[model samples]
Target: MASSLLKTYKKFKWLPFGNWLFSKAICKRAPYFATIKPKVTHLSSGRICAEMPNRRAVHNHIGTVHAIAQCNLAELCAGVVTDATVPNHTHRWIPKGMTVQYLKKADSDLKAQAQIPLPREWKDKEDLIVPVEVFNSDGVKVFHADITMYITEKS
Candidate 1:
């Protein structure tokens, strides 16, 4: 019981907010996402995850997370992961484009998780697709996006 509690405590000790705070303080030159504030919900291994609730105005007249907002969410997740994964001196990452499928209208809080291919390697400059799944508060997959990111490597 103590071990379980300690594990859980340790997990929460370094909250996602702490990680985000550290990221924000240390990495300030993040392009496109510099001014956008996204609450980081999870980050483990090379995966970065986030969640945002759709307010009344953040949606379209149909009331949803909005297509553009969904794209933003995808970008934020992929950007954070790339920021955390790639070495600054040797690599730079920029989002190229996103192919998204709106499975349903997200009326509640939405969860977005970003992940790259396992055992990521930076052999050469390449374009990569980082897949993110967005789930609604009811745990339904309301959206899925494959974001293309252009990565440049320093020789």
Candidate 2:
């Protein structure tokens, strides 16, 4: 199933407005994802990339992108990549916890990238760690997160 979805995404990913349409579909499932308006730049097994604009809605009092907003982007990248990598019929995953670091002020649009080595085989259940890095428009590393996802077999 994951492979099938990836194929569908790849087929349309190059079309005009394709990324936006894909993002909208994701936001529909996770409504809060709409708040940041994330645009998925890439999606493949074990890798995902997304970006969000630094706008007023996501700004902090001091005018930088809010820390939580960055966290949201990180989670979105991580979740999408995980979903693409894990076999849907055999395993499912949910975020267990996240450890985040705010390295610098996010004063511009932010891009988040997450990657993990594809597992050779799926365990019935396990804790998988997915690391996400967030960078500002200038390509400066602004935030980082290690999201732990609990993977379990579908009953």
Candidate 3:
């Protein structure tokens, strides 16, 4: 069975601006995510891609996208992918921690892609690591994050 999030994605992905609507629905549920104004371009069982504009709100003193803003994009992709991959009604997940590296200055709009392997079975609890990479519009990798999610079977 597909997760509710994945079901929502499939239902809306074919309509006009559907992906953007799906992203907004997610933000409505998790309000803090609205800060990045994310647009989820692609979402699947184990992979997701999202983008954020390089506007003044996300810029730093040097005029590059702020590091924390990049981190927010990373987390958004990671969390969504994790939710899409996990079995609905059987398991739930929360971010445990994150390790990140900023490789280059982000001067353009940024896109983030996150990937994780699908779990074959459920456990009482496990730490799943989702890896995400953010790239500039030129396709240069600018930031990377390894997000740890603590997943557990629902009671």
Highest-lDDT candidate: 3
Query: Between prediction 2 and prediction 3, which has the larger lDDT?
Result: 3
Residue-level lDDT of model 2, residues 6-124, one tens digit each, is: 77678769889888888888899899999999999899999998999989999999999998899899999988888889888788899999999999999999988999886667787
> Which has the better TM-score: candidate 1, or candidate 2?
2
Estimate the TM-score for candidate 3.
Answer: 0.96
The candidate scoring highest on TM-score is 3
Q: What's the TM-score of every candidate structure?
A: 0.76, 0.94, 0.96
Question: What stretches of model 3 exceed 4 Å from their correct place?
Answer: none
| Error at 21, model 1, angstroms | 4.2
- Write down the RMSD of all candidates, one decimal each: 6.8, 1.4, 1.1
Weakest 10 consecutive residues, lDDT, candidate 3? 116-125
Q: What local lDDT score does residue 53 receive in model 3, on the 0 to 100 scale?
A: 93
Q: Total clashes, candidate 2?
A: 0
Sorted by lDDT (best first), the order is 3, 2, 1
* Candidates sorted on TM-score, descending: 3, 2, 1
Q: What is the overall TM-score of model 1 with all chains considered together?
A: 0.76
